[model samples]
Target chain A: MVFTTAVNFIRARGPDELWRKRRIFKLAAHFIGRKRNCYSIAVRYVHRALVYATKGRKLKKLDMKDLWETRIIAGVNEHDIDYRTFRESLYRSDILLNRKVLADLAAWEPYTFKALTDVAKRRAIDDGLASINNEHKVDGIITRGALTKS
Target chain B: MSALKRVQQWATFARIWHIYDATWQNPFKSAEVVKKFLMGLYKPIYHPLNDCGDHVIIINSGEIALPGDEWKKRVYFHHTGYPGGASWTLAWELHTKDPTMILKKAIYNSMDGNLQRRHTMQRLHIFPDANVPKSLLDNVSNQIRQLRPVPTRLDRYTAEEVASYPKLIDYPKDYIIR
Candidate 1:
């Protein structure tokens, strides 16, 4: 039973790891042993294996989230925007793209990424949120517009 | 080509070979029998240790005719792992989010959460709609037929029926004398 458990753990590290880590085998081991009535030791081993299998399934979501963020950061770097700043800017501008969609776009499309960035910039300009480097020239234009309106 | 593929193909062939549908114009309905049938829990080959079984696709899950007020009275409970975090969601709510989950949860509870138990569970499939997609229906195509089995009662009699029956004492004394 110990040897089989060790083998299963090792096999679970392979590419088709999901199947290897699956709880079916542990359940079978316990059930078969229980039915035999004499193989109680195997039943205990199955119980332990089931606990580990369930734990692994719960961790799968966390692992998938980590993969998604890694992909997103890689994509963000390609577009010349620091990951944190770009994410903040997107939220500040009210872009509602989820991490899954963002990661997909980053990996599959570069032109779309640039267009998104450009829209964010345009929105900032229209909202009067972007800080102007030359205040005097923009101030003169603003004063001229106010005078024309009067 | 792969071992898994070969095994899957063989299992599919085997399942198709033994599939059957039967009907009784009037048959006894018991919770034990219904649970066993719905969960695929009755087969001789049922292994609590292994998930080696054919997939069961339950059609018209919503249309399941319950025996009594079991739908309203039965409650499911879960914990979020925080103090005072125990929550109870009604069976009806679970039916909407994923109707398949209602039956799946029942089966899961019956199987007792063990490693092998989880494996066999993945083989079971429940679709809320009568028309399951072609991809899923492909496996059971040989056995697929309109199972209009006379809408068999899930339980023996309704509460109203049980209440309406006259007692021996209710019989008229004059009728007995006659």
Candidate 2:
């Protein structure tokens, strides 16, 4: 507890405290007061601000998913089908395309999406799915079932 | 850009969820579902810091239920910072004031204490009387299933259906059934 220099006053809290304050200051540097000599004030706001930054990252992902689903729905609507039937058909057919890929195909690759939709349509017909157009095309045709047997 | 890194990022960042309002059907159980949707915990890519939660449009919030005596006993506290500025409002009173407040407050308190939470709260859409705007109605792409079957009211039952409804032991002709 003996100190000969001014270093002791800042060092009294230990070297760890100094680095913690420095880290917070670095994070808050762009902001107003945290970058200044106000250590106590900076500590409280910086922690809260950092928490917000982290939470924002998660929120961004949720937003992206919503956007993707919407894009897919919009794209699907053009094909004379609702998103649910299209998606349920996709699931039943075991195409395994996630929302991101489905949305991309719906947006950029119309033919590819159409092909997938056709495949889903075929399976949907086989599964006796309700609420779809073109059920008549695949009805009473056991092509998939026949193929599996042969 | 390695393909593996690109795939990893895609897997980490892409997902949306859908929720249905079962509050009118089963109020107590529906709160947990609403909380999960608001928190964005249903997705594999969920992270504490990211605002990756999906938009939750809860219809029929005005008809939601509170189990036990919570509707009367549960109180929300606020302060104006004046001398004796503290005020407490019962849950039912708050619900009457703003039908959405119950769900909103439930979501708000469940979320982590952080600045980003307000942005997440913006995604919550509650319709008290189910007369929601068309824009919000369009946003509902899917529905979360209710935990319990919504019971049919007597008014909705047809004469045949009511007659067919299972009867308790036919009281003996001598005994008058109330």
Candidate 3:
């Protein structure tokens, strides 16, 4: 009897609930599913939603700095130096580069970024912050034999 | 590559665009321009019902510039929606207590006085320092295209011509009046 009642209730309201949830998600999902054509728009709205949620909050300071570090990492990626090593070196060498300017410099000009990265790497090495290799290190995966010679 | 990356890039570009624009115009007005740009007033597709707008990330709000005696004379007011219950904050005090308040006020002024305004205002990102979030950089590119066009300067002759025109009065300066 209970099972029958539950089935009847779901039959009467299940589709409505499902539709409502889908509609709510679709509002900001932008280009997902049938709206794949509007992917860029959807993506932008989602990004804005995240940014908005953190605004005016007292904890926003902690939140935004993380955002800066992430941008720095992405910018540093172009220079073949991961964010961790570069930042560690900066910290060790007492070199000061705020994340805001670093992110801007990285995005606006990648060539200058490469030069900066080279300088950072040199500084890191001088400060004895570079990682040292152990004999047990894994062998290189890409051998010369796999190369296609011209 | 990621949506987060794109938004951060857009925010950074928006900041640079605003700074350069301010330098060309008056640096004192940069805060006002930043507020307007974030409000979607300059977009071609702006519509009353739609909340289509760009996200604005404001960094170092503490370091923004103001013109003249604005820091002393400007007042921010808030009321409890009651008779004779208004509270006021002087600009200089607001700056020292919380510099971010100025940008927030500018943003609020730019928003429409409607229910949707609050929702749209959420897209403003104001950070007083370099501490932006880490999760926001998934797809940021090192390649930023600073494609903003320089605004045209007003012709000096146009203003001069307007001033040079004879001051036409209903009566001559020397005319006798009762």
Candidate 4:
């Protein structure tokens, strides 16, 4: 029975061969159209699917970054600093805070975010960013950074 | 207000503007401002994907003044998608046909060519004069500054100022002979 040892089973590696190429067919069972039914078609689709899955890993990072910036911008409007002004102020003051952390603070810890906004407002005012909406006569709640500057 | 109404109001931060076009500005440049306003870029809440922009009520479009010879030079072209269906029209002619067309076209062209542009255009309400619907006028939250100061009109001159205007030369009684 063991005349050829493990080499005897090597010749039986076709579609019906258990725990071998058929395993790939099992994984590709849910694929669309001929990709699921035909063994030859399934091989090509499975390769293509894996390629797409790898590429999506990089794309997801950029998409999340854009989303975080948008959320941060939505928060900035409430505290009287527009997105451009807030970003500029952070750059000028060397805050080095990323948009993800900033968005978290804005949504969860609003007071902390407002404090940061006030800091940006003061720096932007000092830099004379023309569109910073410097006429804060109405809001009454002055940003803390501007208060510290005075 | 009902809960639904309250939710509706909270969803949109709609601010109405009263923009003026006294001196005719280059539509190419000024239309960008209109597009920005419609897209809510003036607000911190503005996101390219979101419909967070405000309504714009442009007034005094009838008095829009043109600079240089653009009135004669600028032309708008169109095609009917058939043989020999191409046509061209000057800016002034379009403006005459519909007082709002010039500003509307300017705003339309300045916006990005996409589906969202149509929604933004919907928020822009242009009028030939200061007349606006009562509902819209009542909702106006703020007034944006006019584009530029129009030159003082001759009719606005006082009698005394007109009579005292400096003269280069005083013509004699018989000065008409020349």
Q: Every model's DockQ, to 2 decimals?
A: 0.01, 0.04, 0.02, 0.15
Q: How should the candidates be ordered by lDDT, best one leading?
A: 4, 2, 3, 1
| Per-residue accuracy of model 4 over B81-105 as CA lDDT, tens digit each | 9999999998788788887888888
Q: Assess candidate 2 and give its TM-score to the true structure.
A: 0.50
lDDT for each residue of candidate 4 in A17-92, tens digit (9 for 90 to 100): 4555577688788888988877778888888888988999998898878767867876786776778888888888
Native-to-model Cα distance after best TM-score fit, residue B117 in candidate 4, in Å: 2.5
Off by over 4 Å in 1: A1-150, B1-51, B141-148, B152-178
Quantify all predictions' global Cα lDDT against the true fold: 0.51, 0.71, 0.55, 0.73
Off by over 4 Å in 4: A1-88, A92-94, A101-117, A124-150, B1-25, B42-50, B65-68, B147-178
lDDT of 3 by residue, A1-150 (tens): 234565577656545655645554566654445443354555566567667776747476765676567557656654556687777766665767787777666666544555567666655444445451121122222223223210
Best by DockQ: 4
lDDT of 2 by residue, A14-102 (tens): 66777978987887787774344588887777888889989999998988888677667656655656678888988877778988998
Pick the TM-score winner: 4
Tens digit per residue, CA lDDT, model 2, B2-63: 55543343333433445566455545456566666666555433445676677788787887
Native contacts conserved, per model: 0.00, 0.00, 0.00, 0.06
Write the residue-wise lDDT of candidate 1 on A1-150 in tens digits: 244566577755454544543443545543553432433454456667779889989897777666566566655544444556556667776888877777666645544665555554343334444341122121122333334433
| lDDT minimum window of 10 residues, candidate 3 chain B | B15-24
Candidate 3 displacement at residue A77 in angstroms: 33
Q: Clashes in model 4: which pairs?
A: B24-B65
